[model samples]
Target: MLLLQQSSWALYEPVPESYYVHQKNINSVTFEENTTTYLSGQWQYYPKQLLQTATPTRPSRTVLLPISFKEMGYPQNTYGTFIGHFKIPKEFIGRRIAIWIPNQYGAYRMYLNGDFLLRLGKVGKTIQTQQTENAPRFAYFIAESEYFTVTMQVSSFQSLHGGLENPMRIGVSQTVNRQFQQLMMSIAGVCGAVIGVGVFTILFAIFRGVRHSQSQGFFVFGIFIIFLALHNLFSAPYVYTVFTNIDWLWGTRLEYIFTYLSAFFFINYMFLLNQRYLHPAVFTIAVFVLSFNIVITFLSVPEVFEKLVFYSFLLGIIVVLNFAYGFYQTVNRHEPYSTINLWAVVLLCVTFLHDFLLSLNWIDSVNLSFASTSFYAFLIMVQQSKNYAYHSSRIEKLNNNLLCTRQIS
Candidate 1:
């Protein structure tokens, strides 16, 4: 019986030893008696072209297995091949053997005892796992008592962008299954909710128009919802197709512009809901600043657009503070809808904080879509409060008119 274990150098400090035991022949042997031995250590690597002719020589350079090529200090321009030699015991004649590579980049070819066994390649730009099988006899025929050699030829194209530090890992495992079904499901659910909310908001806006003609805040809020919904939908695969044909640089610029515009609209709406109209000067200044954001978004370079977006974020915080103060003043005084508007303002502020943290990568678990949903819920509550205020005002006016008419009669 042999026991085998393998692990990465970064993760584990001490390598464990494996023990093999032999017992006298018995009538029957249980499956539990069998043990696995792991072939784990540094391997000699050479350029792919040199593998065919050059004699195998151990270089002083040593790299841990299941590692990335880039981290090994290989030339940035080329992919290298790795060769490892190990001995198998003569007693392990009829047992099945398997090799596992925890991670690999781009593509890889596997060979056993200098004989080609499998080739794996990704079908698209996305990371996908593919497998090729070899006959069991190939494994049996290749097993040797002295030393069995295994070689891997791995490549990472220079043109491939993103995640350059991703590593290649190899191990031997009896089972292999790597799929992220649950994560995909969660992403899908969030995307569906975002799209659904967007659709509903658009339909509500079309049918209801502005709830109050004099309240520019109501119109702004509706427009903000529309833009936000569209942004969320665009983040998913379904609508990505329409934008895929567009130039990448322009598409990115447009995305930032839309995000800033949505934030601006929301801020303006919150101010109106709190009945705290900004002074004409402040309002005009905000408009000018937002216009500048728009103009800069069209710049060919992204750095300028990023700076404008950051400025817009700061402006949004200022607007929120202004609205909060207005709600504080009005909630205690005259406005009938003030309390509800105040609550909505508070919720909106919280949503903003959550979203900001998410954007900064400070919070990992909470999705931005949840904050958007809460925003829409708050909008509905504020709209209902407005309706209640309208009806209360109308009843009061009628009551006063009746009392005066009775006195005159």
Candidate 2:
């Protein structure tokens, strides 16, 4: 009962209802303590124009919020402006309201009620004049009027067409901040759990001894878990919120590096496990392949991340191939824990494919590296249990033989 009482906050968290604009404005919205809203729908879009504090003129067209860079024929490598019209209950006049622009690609200047509130990245008319930033932005202001206008000037010169790719959030200050807090907390919680799995895996490997057949691979697998967690941390919104001034380039580099290491360590573990079936020549081939990708990453610019996206797909293929062979070996040898390996490989491959398509921008879903690792860890633990049983029986037999020989002597 006490546990349930403590968890009641989870149930009481502000629930957000999504709302879209119609006829260029959203009206009759009410702000409450326990609710927030997504500012979506159609907004006035002015192409190739960067407006200042003045009201936007007749829009050249309209684009929906949460639209992709290519959606609705939205052009790439262009500057633009968006105007959002919203009306709230009069009770909000004396209270504070906040707008949250979730982290995503692009850079912009934000204005509310004809006042400049945020300038995240340089918004310019040309590529030479723009600097792209992908991070969350927020502003709070006392509502002086029932109707408010939000104007944004955005530039998409150097990235996957930044613009307004994500929906902005609006609510009373507390509710909006609470939403951001929850997002960060969820991400941190997942990362922390993955790290715990990693530490336990390492400890288990040590307990089994360095001479154990699975120890090397199991230890490396633990390292992979740690790398995976770090990669997720850097890639998530949590890092952006903590390191507000972090360059997009440096953050991405760390993310990419960790991603590469995680894949490498996991693949290495696979090689170690299948040494009987895999030749040393294959290890050389794998190293050469990964080394090439690493070299290119270090030599290239930030744009390398997008251009080298093929690397992500290639990594996915390698990961799936390694797991497939393990599954085959397990089934062929009739390992007692083969069932666990089968399901682990299948689920890992599925998650890898999900992330694979997500990398290519073909799908939208949660990154499942942590889930995949957890599944693999479970399989590893089960296999270790089998090894312990086998080794214990052998030791017991040795003890019996020694005792009988001593008695005879």
Best by lDDT: 2
lDDT of 2 by residue, 1-409 (tens): 1111101010111112332323445545566876778777666777777775334354567667766556657666777777766777777776778777776666788777556777776888887787776666677777766766677888776665456666677788778877777776676677777788788888878997967877877788888878878877777453444534557666666767777777677667767767533445655566666666667766765565556656556645655665667567766888644456567757766876787676555776666766576657657667766877999999999999999999999
Writing each residue's lDDT as its tens digit, candidate 1 over 87-192 gives: 4554543334444332233455666645566554421222233221111011113222334555666554422211112222221223211111232344445545
Model 2: CA > 4 A from native: 1-24, 27-31, 53-59, 89-91, 203-211, 243-245, 275-286, 311-315, 318-322, 325-335, 364-409
| Runs with alpha carbons beyond 4 Å of true place in candidate 1 | 1-218, 234-247, 274-279, 338-340, 357-370, 373-409
Q: What lDDT, from 0 to 1, does candidate 1 have?
A: 0.47
Instruction: Compare the candidates by TM-score and give the number of the best one.
Output: 2
lDDT of 1 at 160: 24
Worst 10 residues of 1 by lDDT: 19-28
Residue 206 lDDT in candidate 2: 92
| C-alpha lDDT (0 to 100) for residue 92 of candidate 1 | 42
